[model samples]
Target: MLDRPTFTISNVRSGDVVSYPLVLFDGQLHGASAATSVTVSRIGADHPRLRAHTYTAPSQAWPVALDTGVFKALAFLVPGENVIEFRAGAEPVAAIHRLVVHYLNAPWDYCVRAVYVVPADDPVGGFQAPPHERCDIDSAVHRLALAMRLLQSALAELMHRHGLGRYTFCLEEPAQARACPSEGGYEEVLVAYGVPVHVHRFKHSRAALQALSGDELYGRVGQALSGAPDRESRIDVALMSFTRKDAHTGMLYGHTALGGGRLALFGSGSMFSWPENLEQVPRRFTDRTAVDGRRFLDDSAGRGEYWALASTSMGAVLHELGHCLSLPHPHNGGGIMARGFDYLYRLFGVAEPQPGAEMQAPDEPRLDRSAATRLRFHSYLIRAGSEPHPATLYPPHPPPAPDGAVSVPVPSPSPTPTPPRPRLYVATNGLPARARAHHEAHSAPRRPSITWQSEGVVRVSAPNGLGHIGYYLNGDVAAHEEFFQASAPVHLLDIPWREVCRQCGNPPAGAKIRISCVDHAGQIEEAFERQVGDRP
Candidate 1:
């Protein structure tokens, strides 16, 4: 294919010939090879009747020109975002290539790599619910299809925003080609209404889908998209289905872009397994679970990448799409992509683009315009033959924690038992760091206690009703299952060291040490320094 393939379209202004390179993908190549025959027809949303065109393979086999008749017929097809389904006759699998068909636009192409279908069950797909007596497989399939379409559309939008102008969808025409139960499977039913079908052994699996590493998925999709033999003969988007909810050991995973940059759809078992109308699978993690101590990351591990956490809604999918397109949370974006459901909803009532709206680069890894454009393409593909009202926009949310009074705790000294030491020393005054003081307030509770051994190994008892206790001198907070102190007058050494110290070096005559203790709330008490041995 030429770096630019010129296609002339009429029914518009001058210079209708626009050239955007077609992504020659393997699926298209395979589709063309197997297609007994193909016919290109212009069925515009606003245009008149349908017109047919011819596309033939070349003799020299270098680069083939679309038939002149086909070119003329294509010329009549009006521009500005169109869905062109490449019709297949008796082909085992049907394919539809949806090209945005822009007139004289810049070079553009979009690609959707792997897709997700999060279920209403375990988001991770580990636990299986007790099988219900009545199962609604059709409903499950519908949800699966809905999720797939959302993923496809979001990815296409990402690609389109990145400047890709073409989109496609491929699915195996079921052999029986039976009509899906009245309500669900409308798209598939209409497309493959009377066509023969092709069957695949396995469809989608949540746990196994992430088997493909990020690099593998990226490289393979890029390669297939850049180099396929048949440029315009086959469908662009490739539809893959999964029978099981796709998952791995972790929350994240990726898959390869098969058949040349064609998008992959992973319809998991949950699609055919979960009850319809279910949203937000409730999950709780204990301290021992993997989710415990786990922190969600702000960035993806690579360039041209994004991340998502699934909720059983289109909004959640949109949020993920934002990530996939390299768009940050709208809260951070100000308003460009923010929504109430996202983390930023509790604050201001208006949705505003983040502080640096014009700036594109994020310190963390993200998708570029190229990826976003591709996502737009997927979005177009998913919304094909249908219209969904645009999502409602919301405002920025405030932080979860509030700014308020700092809470503090009182301390109690515990007893200590120890052997007598030859040396007895006393230090007077001290001041604690702000961090240490704050930490004590939160860590210690109302009934706090401290334990430490005396230098003489003497036993010291502590006040029974003391509220909190603090460790002396050390900046680190201390907690133990059992107390070590026997008792305490709260002074170091049994000697009248204060008078002795005053007599000796006159050691400033009145210095004091501060300590931290626990309180009733299991938090630490604040530190207080005192003066010793004045005239009193």
Candidate 2:
């Protein structure tokens, strides 16, 4: 067993930067076969409390010199005494550490910063350095810092596209740049990506991040920090920690939403790899799932469903922000309003931008037309001050779905730009529940061109190997469902092989079918004049 480490905290006058030293004395105190990262956070008893203020420069060994980022960002530390808390992973390691934040008295001007690309160095199969060898702890910390900065830049882009909202990124691993010695590469990464970094502890415990409340989370951070000065405003904040476990592949790193509308990411050393988009990262070439997934989006391992990486990784972020905007995914196609379908590239050869790829000057990454519509739909859900929690953003009510899916297929040679339609969803107590795809009928049918299938009682198709199914409903706008009053054409996509069922519970009677869809803008629009005839 290792002796518990002790530390203190002191208050600094506002507008000052403070520094501390982290020492690991026990020679027997060895780092887990992976790199060990640490961070310091402020724990106050208020809404959105427990803010991570400093991330220890990542390292493989203990007892390293400590210069934290949080101190740097808040250049206005007071010279008084304060108690800052120290957390290893997400758990509290040392509470109420006394520290002094002294003013540097240096004049520093600020400007809009951006994220640039950097190269990375490979580390061992795991996060830790080989035992006894000079562990490259400094490089690791710097690398993590750079990654945080880059993500911050991305968040800015997201904010510009969506409305201004406060959010934060939580870390799950020891982010490092070089091995033992900090090198130019690590420096490059830090300078290139300008975001904050945190050392999040990895754990399966339900009590993880017990320090931070729901209001302090991203969804509610804006209101919590609303009183802060504008120049010192932060759009994205990051909280991170680490963990120790015997397994390698047991959910090394993954992100999930907490009940209070908070989101956290957990990962092991093997799960946290050096970043490729940043420079001089000391990461191993091993195929750690988390690292591999991140790496795939990085410089190496390019190709083979790679878009899946970008889509899955960044798609959730987009979706979450979409919810804040009161928007839903486009429901005009054969997919639900919640699922992501990249039709721009699939049809028009307009691929999503590659990670770290640059756009023309003055042009930042903007949501496509479809994505824009989906985002706007969320406007209906924004309750503002109704909820006590800062991050609590929920839909006003559940979407209403009929007995079956009413689909309108996109015509062959897919339309240059898809139109909007009404979508039906399952209603929860008169409120909207999870929305599903209503049938999408093609303006015209093409034989043997594409295939479709009905699963979970919904007819849909597979896009890039993802099965998209829509439900058949009863009260469509054309068919007489309450609140549905539009006469829209119905269609299905890549029509799949299936048996005909009765329309509204009678013998299959309609040579023509009507479908409902939710437009990109979250409106309940409909398409009519669809023909569901017998195929010979």
**Which candidate ranks first by TM-score, i.e. highest?**
2
The weakest ten consecutive residues by lDDT in model 1 span: 422-431
| Per-residue alpha-carbon lDDT of candidate 1 for residues 376-423, written as tens digits (9 for 90 to 100) | 222112111111111111012212222332211111111111322110
Q: lDDT per residue, candidate 2, 99-181, as tens digits?
A: 43221111111111111111132322123322322224334444444444433333323322333221112221223221111
Q: State model 1's lDDT.
A: 0.26
Which stretches of candidate 1 lie above 4 Å from their native place? 1-136, 148-200, 203-260, 263-308, 311-367, 372-536
* lDDT against the true structure, each candidate: 0.26, 0.26
Off by over 4 Å in 2: 1-192, 198-239, 243-370, 373-536
Q: Give the Å error, residue 321, model 1.
A: 10
